[model samples]
Target chain A: MSDTPENVAATNAEARNERHRERMVRKKTVMDERIANAQSERGLLLVNTGIGKGKSSSAFGMVARALGHGLKVGVVQFIKGRVSTGEQLFFKRFPEEVRYHVMGEGFTWETQDRQRDIETAGKAWEVAVELLNDPGIALVVLDELNIAFKHGYLDVDQILEDLRNRPLTQHVVVTGRGAPQALIEAADTVSDMSLVKHAFQSGIRAQKGIEF
Target chain B: MSDTPENVAATNAEARNERHRERMVRKKTVMDERIANAQSERGLLLVNTGIGKGKSSSAFGMVARALGHGLKVGVVQFIKGRVSTGEQLFFKRFPEEVRYHVMGEGFTWETQDRQRDIETAGKAWEVAVELLNDPGIALVVLDELNIAFKHGYLDVDQILEDLRNRPLTQHVVVTGRGAPQALIEAADTVSDMSLVKHAFQSGIRAQKGIEF
Candidate 1:
């Protein structure tokens, strides 16, 4: 006996539902175990890295999250001082909760002076170190520091040492491409964004709010 | 000739400076041409997908960017209607510019019915379709719609057709894991977030404000 069209559709829907139930049951078991075992809580070291464009964007979003929680936040920028970003402009509205610092001279091409870039990176790192040590600051963002770290303007070892001794209650988010292995090892969470496609590659100029 | 520690440090810094200058000069030429040729401007279909986290967070960051520019924005949340997210709470500050819609029955585990899930997804798509056709809305974020697309609850072809017919000046950002190949191909920009390390993998529970 052949099944009717209505019956076939119902059967297909039932089969899909059963498959979803089984998969989620297995996931629940794993997640429950993980959640049960999590007893210790402390501030996290999060690194957003890779060739994708959303690394810095995600880090800044976390800044918004931190601020929403009534947490004090500090932001330090390195190697990207030419353009004031939308995130910076928006966060400036809340001066009481956010300490914003744009400490880079500019891009290497724009500045063309390695000595100046190094000095600027040094100043930004100084700010980062201070932010990391401040227990009152709940979240600190080291935006684009990975670019300077990649270019050797900043010492990875020194930064790692500072991160190790950061305040127990202060969260830190580091963003940029080519994050060093040491920082990755030291971080509690790491997200590496992979570029499937970028608007810039398609001859789209960096717009004011989107790119900045 | 043997040199003092300070002299060796000074000489090394100078050599490093010289290398950076040469490398940057070459990089500048390439970047200049790339920047010069990038002249196109249009609204984009951006998809953030993969198993890694931060897909929705980045999408919301774009919403903030859109809002910062005083653009009208619409956000539709799918499959995450159970918990209130930080982005939703914060975006509610700008009620005039944002039209927020949470139209899901929670995760599949909680819903457990394929027919119900399909109906919920359809309703969310209806809201998204309305937003897409509205030229006054500068950006529309379809959060977690990929899950519906991944599960066959929604027709990918229908979505592709709708995306093709969307308002010319309106940007759409779709966020979730396991985006279909067709959507990826149709999208102007795509970012695939890869997990290096996740807090959940280390038996860490999702904390309030950070995870939500």
Candidate 2:
């Protein structure tokens, strides 16, 4: 009786499968119990105040998540318009569910036009307001809009008033450093991402895939 | 003229808003661009290998993202049986989009019935596989499924084969420790969450609303 390695391996695999089957036979299980679900009602969310990593990343991740379910998601990015980044690049993959709009001036320094910056911010705000009213649109991520309010390009009062008045089913996410008192107070969930430490502070240039 | 503190505070608030508006007008602002959307073609995936943290949390985060877009998602947790969890608790918020299947056996040591464990895992897998194929089901997260394979309660190859053949548009995520090499190899993108450092090792019990 010759015993081959292949035969032995096969025998072992069968035994493993048998063991697995045995375990399943004795365990009791429950099917269909979910704890966390997406917010159905309209609410305001402020991803605010602090120099921390993953604020934009987290927001974009949410955007991607929303788009995955065939939801109309509108994103308006502020204080970021240099070269293309990961989020922007990936946004092209799903143009139907996601609409991407940028202020287009790049950072506040590169434009060097104060009047133009305010005009651009105001225009973006108009679009965001319009999106807020569209019930078909499930999420409106105002990326870095806090910086706009902090800089005073757009009226904080108007922004807050509009957000409050927007359709109740529309969920809004405002992200940026130094979110104002008004925005924070009006928001249902306020997440302050305090930066304990960062790689950029240590002189590590942002990597392509990880940072961008 | 009676000068009151309330009057002074109101005046200060208006001045603060004015100052912010002026500063924003001067800043040259740009918006972050969304390059493209998420890779929806990438089917659902779960990474369960070794006890670091961020496994189930990350998975559930994606689930929330999906649900926010009005997409249906299902979750099945093994080894987390007979007990309530933060994820389970949160699922109540969205009773429609999120469906859960929990094994009542809890952990293997607690049950000590290998046959029953395997049977329960098989039953859960049956439901999970059903969801994986459902085109309307955008994302399916099998939380802590690695334990099922590790303890000989589930068949890794069979699961991988099923996933490989599932609906192309549907996304799935699995989270747990000790994920099998076969599953890793089969994944379109495999993120191995190595434990370089963890808060739990430093004498911090899992806190509610954070770790749980």
Candidate 3:
């Protein structure tokens, strides 16, 4: 109420706060409507793909969340079996809750045998199909399955068909780079994890319990 | 060797495999050298930010990894205290292993009080600082702290200063949208999660286990 500079500033701040509050009220109404309209619930096909980190990590995070809710999770890692990762070591502890299978011999370059790679991928897919068909498995993470599709090791059409026909209440998270267009189209949620910067590029070694 | 169609295909495949093997051998040498050169090991400042999902989920994944390695973990959630997410519910089960703190009244819009929001963020920062200072806590997750900085509730410079002075082997992961430029520069690794498509956009509600 005073003419002083401090009082004027306070008054202006109050007005701004009032405006923000009103805007938020309008936003809340719209959000409420959207939430109300979204009554449908079922399985989701989540794709975490791109050239960035965290795609698999995010999927693993969901694995943790799923386990928290006492859900059974099945993880079929398709192309990273050379060295054991931290996620593998950690999730394997919950043997009853998580069915984790590290199905790759190693990276494609390391494998270098096309016939063997296809065989390995086929084996992994068999395990994945089993998980997908099981109603008890709440969340199935097909880690790096896209890379198999990208390298023509697995049939994309077949993978899509299997994903489409999975249990009604089961959730699937597919992670890796170059997720096929068809898979993206079939996905319910798709996150493109983009690399902004990497510690490895900055001369930092990938350490245990972090990168792995 | 036979000159039949099957024989010809086998020969071509063998030649291709040989060529690929040679390429991989060369690549391995370069990779081995890079691995040998990266000898430095210490604490890392990691930032996961952008307008997409999984920023927090990936951080949670790292927390799982850290815990898997028998490392102590700490989590401080900012601007997400209104609703108890699955991560919070799940992580809270491990009281001895995890020092989890949910320190926010709600989102900024819901709170509608700048003073209160700032105070809550300051309190969260206090908890974060404690985690950062503890050398025993191997990994500390500052979930949605970037949003607090984005809304001007906390000082970026001060946050960076604390991060820089943390324990020698401590690893920190900050997750949320609009990570400050300073924080990104300070980070060892930064991932920008971009939304390709979201289920909520397709008339699906945020589910209990997946979204939370």
Interface RMSD over true interface Cα atoms for each candidate: 1.9, 12.5, 1.5
TM-score per candidate, in order? Answer: 0.92, 0.47, 0.96
Rank by DockQ, highest first: 3, 1, 2
Alpha-carbon lDDT, every model: 0.83, 0.63, 0.88
- Report how far off residue B89 is in candidate 2 (Å): 21
- What are the per-residue Cα lDDT tens digits for candidate 3 across B62-179? 9888888788999999967456787887888899999999998887767777778889999999999999999999999999999899878899999899998999999999999999
Q: Candidate 2 lDDT (Cα, whole model)?
A: 0.63
> What is candidate 3's CAPRI-style docking category based on DockQ?
medium
Per prediction, the TM-score for chain B is 0.93, 0.75, 0.96
DockQ of each: 0.58, 0.05, 0.69
Regions more than 4 Å wrong, model 3 = none
Categorize the docking of model 2. incorrect
TM-score of chain A of 1: 0.90
Of the true interface contacts, each candidate retains a share of 0.51, 0.02, 0.63
Better by lDDT, candidate 3 or 2: 3
DockQ of structure 1: 0.58
Screening candidate 3 with a backbone cut-off below 3 angstroms (N, C-alpha, C), the clashing residue pairs are: A86-A212
